[model samples]
Target: MIRRLAAFARPFSAWLAASAALRVLHLALGIAILTVAARALAAGADAVATAGTIVVLAAAKGTAHYGEQYLGHRVAFTVLARLRTDFFDALARQAPGVLHRHRSGDLAARATADVNRVEVFYAHTIAPALAAVVVALGSAGYLAAAAHPALAVISLAGAAVSGLAVPLLGRRPVRQAARRRQETRGLIAAHVADTVGGLRDLALLGAAGRWERRLGALEERAAGDTRALAARLAIRRAANTAVLAATVSAVAVAGACLWRDGQLDRQSWWAAIAVTLAMAPALTAVEAFAGESGTTVAAARRIFEIIDVPRPRVPPPPAPAPPGPSGSAPPRPAPPARAATTGPATTTGPTIIGPTIIGPTVIGPTVTGAASPAAAERRAAAVSARGVGFAYPGSPPVLAGVDLDLPPGSTTAVLGATGSGKSSLGYLLAAVLTPTHGTITLDGADLRDLPEDLIRRRVALADQRPFVFSDTIAGNLRLADPGADEDLLWHVLETVDLAEAVRALPGRLRTRLAEHGADLSGGELQRLSLAQALLRRPALLICDEVTGQLDAATEARLLDRLRRDSAGRTTVWITHRPATLRAVDQVVVLDAGRVTTPAGPRLSRAGAARPGLSPAGSPGPASLGDTPGPRGPAG
Candidate 1:
């Protein structure tokens, strides 16, 4: 971690060097001022010359101090900016899967507080350590040159003890305290963020008081950790101060004895005393920074933990076929032609491939020896999961051998009880989660082989509880399609039955939303999410209980609009709502990590009787067994 931090500092090497140089100059000036003042007082030197020299040295010290501070902080903040950018980029790569192992609040603290703490490594730790070395060595050399080799030895030894030995006295305890302090801080930050986000829900459940007590307990624990750390630091500071005083007093007394023995003149005696005092500042700086070193190390380790997460591998594109003999281009063989598909979509089970033409599209780079564009467009995005399985780390499998097929242009509804893997299946189909045991193919091509950006563009998933940024309605819409204009935004809003409400807002599309759409009602928030997904016009749209918060009338109207608008698009509606099931072409039921046969009656596009089902029957396969009543699906 230290080596990695050093690399980040490389970009600001020039500024750091300048700051170190200025710091050395500042210390040198202080030494010169003290020596000159001592010489003037002992010999009763010319008053005007003495005062002018003292004034000049003081001014130079002040100037160097200013330059050092300016350059040091400039380097610190610049390095911080780069560190934050890299941290966020690494976090983004691990998101939604690898990051699920960490709490959102803990991750947030890492991004903000942890990154801020790293500034000290560059600003206080590295620069000061360098300057201390220079000041210490220069002071020792000055003492030797002044005809006091004995004093020089004493000064160097004192410098070593102060810089090196003093900091090591309580190393283990100080380090432990620092780690505990930072950990407690992160916990407090995470808890506060979670409480704020769910304050309303807690209030409704009459559990707000309990949560408040929990937060207070966390805060008290953090404060206790901080106080413990402070007490340890105070002890260290007192020990360092005593060491500095003893070293300086011993050197001063040794210089006086040498002067009395006729080994040194008056000027030399005063100069030696002044030089001894000069070493105090350099030693003190090192001792003080040692305490902070523990905190810096702990913070850096936390940051690297996130950055070191392994990124998903993307396969290299296949190399073009070797040139034919004689340097002449060989005629390429025509790709296999697929039969045109029509009628209502159907599935045999979770693993069976439906009779739909799966082909690639132009959203991603076309692979060599692939089907032609015209043929690909004629085919729908046929998704199939063959023995697909997934489970969170250290947990039993949530989805096992989940074989299923989604025909092109088919509207399929996934129905299951809570914890039956409905949303997990949706994530798998949308390419958000990779199958652990089997293969998921997009148009006969392994989804993993496709570029992530291409999959995101072609497959849109509207989460049950969508996240809305604190931006205008138009701004949120632009997140799906950046170049979409006002007309396009209004069109998607109208499709989700949210146009009229938005139009009545003070600024219409431009009216800014509070954090996470706090200003909008629950139904409005869901509709807004749908509108954003609709704007993308994705090839596959996965709605994971998108209408769970809407009223029956609004839900029916939105479903009708979705069925009409997504005419040729493959729609995976992950819902248990019977009203939503009426609009889909077919329904697949899941039970305990397996795909069960649908027990609901199959309905036509008009929700009327199908050829194989009884009239007024629920729509689906018989394997689902004992479908719920016609009122609506439960949570």
Candidate 2:
């Protein structure tokens, strides 16, 4: 895992090398100052000369120290920024599917707090560890040449004990404590997010006290982990101090014995002591950073866990077959001519793929000429599911062997009670969740084979509970269409019947919403989410109980608008409400993860029934007034 993290710093290798070199230079200067002063004192050299030499070395040491700090932090912050980008990109590749399996607060903690913790490894650990090794060895070798070989042996032993053995021995317990603390922190963040997001509901249900107690328990666990980590760190510090004191005293006593035995001169004795003391700073630094390693390693593991999850790689669409192996491209066939009255209108402005619908409300718009290739594909995207099946990990299957077809420009209603897989089916059709069995297709091409951007652009799903960022109303709506003007924003809002309510606000489009749109009522929040989705003008719009929060009158109005403006668009309404089926052209019932057609009059296209549409069961022209659903009748 440490090796993997080092790869992220590859782009900043030059900075790292410079930082490490400066650090080594700084420590070397400190050792030089000590050696110079010790030898001068033993020889009774000129005071002026010794002081001058020491002062110059100290000045140089300070400069190197500054440079090392600057470069170390530069590399750390830059690498951190890159890590965040890569983390988000990885999450996006596996999104909706992967997102469902993780807590939002835990994900947020990994991205923010966990990533921040890894900064210690880059800023303090790497270069200091490198410099410590270089300085320790240099000091030992110099002592051997300038003093007795026995003195060098004694110095090396002390350096090794203080720098290597003590640190390595204590690392395991420190790391275990750090890991526990990090996990507890993630849980606390998750609980806080859940509590805050559902605070209104909790208050209404009088569960706030229960939530508070749970939070208190998590805080207690986090506090316990923190205390354990602090205790281990305190013990390690005491051990390092003890080792340092013992090593210095042993070196001094050994040098004194050598001098007394006439095996060392006074100058040689002082030089040996100076070199031995020089090893202290480097070895002590190694010990200090070792304590920090436990926390850094734990945080890094958390970050990599998310990045390493398996994500589907959607290949780019195949190039246009290499121009058919000719010098010039082959002549393209012209589209078939249609009756003048039946032909769709053309526009010089932006090509609208289909009518814009928010939730179950629609804002009318028609396609135009000079369309991009992607736009042309979106104009008539037919979808089909063949024996689709899905199940969450460690849970029973949510959907199974379901077959359904949504013809271009058609509206279908999927009616099922809670836990009947209506939302799961919608997710599969919208390409947010991949089917574990069989296939789902868009325009005869398998959805799994298509690029993510193409799927996102052509299909839009207005979730029953959509996320709203803490931003102005216009800002939230602009997420779907950043270039949408005030006129367009108001138009979509009006279509969803949210314009009047918004206008009554003090800031109107500029009004800032609380996190999760906490300030707004449920119906307003849903309409705002719907308006945002409508800005995409997708060919296929999937609404998963988007109108569930609205009253019957508002739901009726929204559905009426959807029926009027949903021309030339494929719409799927996922709801348990039977009255909502009035605006749909056909209805399919999902029960126990299976799709079966109900015995009712179904709307027919051009007064004709589609054959071979199995899994949809018997086809018929359903009367608009009939109340059809899973409990109404069986095929």
75-105: candidate 1 lDDT, tens digit per residue: 8889888878878877765546654577788
C-alpha TM-score for every candidate: 0.80, 0.80
Candidate 2, residues 1-635, lDDT tens digits: the string is 78887888888888988999999999999889988999999999999999999999999999999999999999999999988887897787666666667898988998999999988878887888899888878888887888888877887888888888888876788899899999999999999999978988999999999999999999999999899988988887788888878877887888899999999899888877787777788887887778878888899988888788653433333233333332323122211211112243222111111111112212223323322344445464688776677776566678866666677866677765556687788888888777777788998999988888998878888887788999999999999999999988987887788999999999999999998798998888888878887778788889887876777678767775555445445788876554454455456666567654333333232122222121122222332112243321111
Superposed by TM-score, candidate 2 places the C-alpha of residue 586 at a distance from the truth, in angstroms, of: 3.5
What's the lDDT of the predicted structure labeled candidate 1? 0.72
Which ten residues in a row are the worst by lDDT in model 2? 349-358
Query: After superposition on all CA atoms, how large is the RMSD of candidate 1?
Result: 9.1
The 0-to-1 C-alpha lDDT of every candidate, in the order given, reads 0.72, 0.73
